[model samples]
Target chain A: MSVTILYKEQPPFPVMATPDGDDLWLTLDDLRSATGWEIRPEGVCREGQCVPIPEGREREFVRESPPRFNLAALARWLEQPVLHDDVHGVWFFGEAARVRRETLRSLQAPDFRLPDLEGRMHSLANYRGKKIFLVSWASW
Target chain B: MWQGLYDELKDRSFVVLAVALDSGGVASAGQWILAAKPTYPCLIDERHVVAELYSMVNVPSAVWIDEAGRIVRPTEVAGASDAFRTQMDRKTKQVSAEGIADRQRTRTAYLNALRDWTAKGAESPFAVSRDEVRRRSSGPSDEHVFAAAHFRLGEYLYTQGHREAALPYFSEARRLHPASWSYRRQTWELEEPGKAGGPDFWSAVDALGDRSYYPPVTL
Candidate 1:
């Protein structure tokens, strides 16, 4: 499973997925609030695991455990991220969780067949034995 | 990036396929592809069936499938070349100064990083390891899921001329998934009074009715 964030319906940045066999989608705000990192060009931090947000030159920090509990790390361990809405001050936890690039032990890439401009069939199964790089783009 | 790289590695057991998600069918996407004249298998996804299947929500998104039909790189696969950004930035510096430059700059940077990963593959400095990738791919809560459903239903209804009915779905989509661009864009487009072909209808949220209707766009 994987997590994705959408803005007005379009993907704004790269979506984040967690490990632990859960697939969930997340927004940038969702990641920031859960990790306690400002959305500014700094770094992403939670309880124990923190990833540096390097847009420009930024310093890195060590992942440390909190005395009581690393809620962020616990979220990571559980394969879920905390989500908060600044607009409504509402918060919730996602059930299905996933992380990006983690070797998908159960991920099955969906098969698809679609026509091109000339109405020719383009199928995913055609590239069964080859390393296929599929990209999606639009004119608009 | 993949195009040129594919040319280099195609004979070495590598293949690259480009799918255009253009809603205007192949006409627009084909024109662009032909102009670039990419040597790879450039196809088109008119109905967005592949997008729906792969959970693709944006353009220029990529997925890498190994020979075993396993997804080595999923929906967030970025491109391999920074050519798009370099050209965009250079043109922005020379073009008209109507705020389009800033927009182009930001968009260009985003595309550049994607290209870097594509070119370098897993060796790319920006490429996340299997662990990091998994850690980052998790999605939002159920509220957002229902919101996405509502947004899709609203878009379907709006297209069917059920504007009033669509309004409720769009409203719910926004309320449930406040961060969704699909939900917000659909609603904004419906309420927009401007000409359709002029510019992006929801280019600026400030022009929309209530700023509080959407979340802050950090990108």
Candidate 2:
């Protein structure tokens, strides 16, 4: 089946997956596409972080027949919040507790890139050299 | 109001970035932005990503970021005062003279503090310390974390033309993080046009009783 992955604040994208009960298993390439993480000899690695797969529990995360990765298990290990809509094949992954904690500790404004009405892209980082009164409102 | 403030401080290197948290996207928020004719950057957040990132529970919430990109103040209610709710005639929806005066006073105080921060940067009394900023920041609780995830899924499903399927997730988000007016209002307005500020909104306000609609401005 195909699944839509909504990762953080980024745009959602779809990837092929094997659904098992409540979990979605994906090939290594699909895993990388769904999440930025890739399985290496060291474990699942992304950027500066490499989490080693638990010894003797490799079967829980890896399947040999078609070679699939258990994204649900990895999410649990990282303490990343994952919400799934079974009927719609959509999954939403939120920031890990540790990541949010680090951001809070840094006391830096979280950066985001969004589009203005004219479809011009603007990033919070672009306004780094000035005082910013960032306010949120709604038409509703 | 924001445009006027932005005009006053833009030359001083201050920027007012207004984010519209509307699930209805450009179709809903663009009209207001067009009318305001703001010179500052006005971005539309169709997915409420800013709310999730900043742990913002309501609209009109704000964060003060310094020149170096440090947060001087974390998310808190910004403009509208309790007087708008408490002092208005329930039938006519008109604010009492006292209410209007009180609302004006609250708005002026907030704006003055903003001006002070723009003028003095880190030295302003209104600029909170790093420790205080960290302390005040609402790191999402487990419920809030899940709530945001559910909200995201709900938004996706709704936009995908699975409107009925989206309701459960939206309801779950609201149940998990009731403090989030953004979650509730977005879901309500998406479910039914104008339901956001309808009688349900007033009932929710009435239910608050002693609790405030917006947290009082600390400055």
Which candidate ranks first by DockQ, i.e. highest?
Answer: 2
Give candidate 1 regions above 4 Å deviation: A1-105, B27-30, B37-39, B46-49, B52-55, B77-130, B154-219
User: What DockQ do the predictions score, one after another?
Assistant: 0.23, 0.84
Model 2: chain A TM-score against the true structure: 0.90
Tens digits of per-residue lDDT, candidate 2, B51-130, equal: 87788999799999898998998888886688978798877889999999988888889899999988988899989987
Which tens-of-lDDT digit does each residue in A19-135 have in candidate 1?
A: 222223234454554434333334454445455443342212222232122233434444443443322222233223233112243344656776655677778788787767788
Give the poorly placed runs of model 2, Cα more than 4 Å off: none
* Candidate 2 local distance difference test against the native: 0.87
Estimate candidate 2's RMSD in Å.
1.4
Q: In candidate 2, how many Å is residue B148 off?
A: 0.7
| Interface RMSD per candidate | 7.2, 1.0
Clashing pairs in 2: none
TM-score of chain A of each: 0.26, 0.90
* Local accuracy of candidate 2 as per-residue lDDT tens digits, A49-135: 999999999988889888899988888878999878777778777888678768867887889999999989999999999999999
TM-score of each: 0.47, 0.96
